[model samples]
Target: MHVRHWENSGGNIWDKYTVKMFPQEYRDIDKIYEQALLVSNYADNAIALAEKLEKAILSLEEQPYRGAERKYGFYAFKGYRQLTVENYIIIYEVFENEKVVAVVTVKYGKSEF
Candidate 1:
């Protein structure tokens, strides 16, 4: 999906929001997907889950404000917002000036921040 953003560093309108997934998010996704594969003994399910998650994270591109303001969070999550997919929460921060969106972490609903 295409997401409109302010002019990029080179002042190009064609540029999309820079999506950066942090190391923690990577580890979280990997752990969850691997568990799914182990439980179901089906790689397809894990693959599908990963693809679905990627799509959810990308939704921040068009409207970063779409996420609700974070309350009662740690210092680093100060300006971050969350997007939920099923039981998973995608934590991210939007750098409007640079037109970048950083996906900080993906955690389960029951987990404490």
Candidate 2:
């Protein structure tokens, strides 16, 4: 992954972290997309939802701390954070020393899983 660096108006360099998704996260997202297609029976809607989720996840590359600390359920004591995209909650953790944001999981907000 390529880390992006940008300059602010004041000529300050802003470092963008690299974003990585766990192998399981990829499988989970694929399953979510498949289930969405099955439930809605609409390819377009499923595609749109997948794209939106991807966009939100990618945004972490530039703003890794944008999501609030996970203080409620599952992984709450593990120092994980969460970013919500539509009905899905993206769980992630930031490794500031390595300048990387790792996505741990993605779960439907309404589901207990």
Q: What TM-score do all the candidates reach, one by one?
A: 0.75, 0.84
By TM-score, how accurate is candidate 2?
0.84
Model 2 spans > 4 angstroms off: 1-14
- Candidate 2 clashing pairs, residues 3+ apart or interchain: none
Q: Pick the candidate with the highest TM-score.
A: 2
Q: Rate the local accuracy (lDDT) of all candidates.
A: 0.74, 0.83
Residue 39, model 1: lDDT of 79
lDDT score of model 2?
Answer: 0.83
lDDT of 2 by residue, 16-104 (tens): 67788767888878988999999999999999999999888887877899998988777786889999988899999999998888888
Ten-residue stretch with the least lDDT total in model 2: 4-13
Report the number of the highest-lDDT candidate: 2
**Alpha-carbon shift of residue 79 in model 2 (angstroms):** 1.7
